[model samples]
Target: MGNLIFLSGQAAIDQIGGVVGPGDIDAQIDQAMANIERALNAVGSGVDRIFKITVYLTDMNNFESVIKMRERYFDKPWPADTTVGVSALALPELMVELDVIATRP
Candidate 1:
């Protein structure tokens, strides 16, 4: 509430609700981050305004890739983060998801 914006987890689904990158963790992460940016923009915030993030992945082995991708999305003093590996997600083809907490710009 107030200046805080808590967003629900965003996955790699396209505008038509179809998964964007089946069997591709890197593409899935990019799509998920795009979704996060779109949602934040819609609510008067941007990725720079984000202060925390929670990432979910189907495989923990992809953690390093996620870290590398994060560099493209966030700046220094990167948001506090937590990443978790799960057996599955809502869509079997979905490989990544991101939820964030941000402040209005």
Candidate 2:
């Protein structure tokens, strides 16, 4: 079996791992995607290999925003995805978190 890289839900965290963008879901999503990219790259994989992702959001209202951001990373034949709304997260500042599953190169 190939390496399966499972990334815990990532929030809008900065280089120091501090929650960023606060109430800005767009910014948070951006950071979360970037974090996901870093994690995938570290393991010799990339977004192209991402087979699935589960997104957690403080509010379901940001669903479209997440989809828009996904376009930035994924193209045709996008990965399987699931988005859920939650009342809270590990931090109040985090508006979005992404659960990533990718196959290693």
Index of the highest-TM-score prediction: 1
lDDT of each: 0.88, 0.87
What's the residue-level lDDT of 74 in candidate 2?
A: 90
Candidate 1 local Cα displacement, residue 54, angstroms: 0.5
- What TM-score do all the candidates reach, one by one? 0.95, 0.93
Model 2, 1-105: lDDT tens digits are: 568989996889899978889888888888898888898888899878998989998899889997887798798788899999999999878888899889996
Candidate 2 to native Cα RMSD, angstroms: 1.2
Assess candidate 1 and give its TM-score to the true structure: 0.95
In model 1, how large is the Cα lDDT of residue 15? Answer: 80
Cα error, residue 24 of model 2, in Å, equals 1.1
Error of 1 at 99 (Å): 0.8
Query: Clash number for every model?
Result: 0, 0
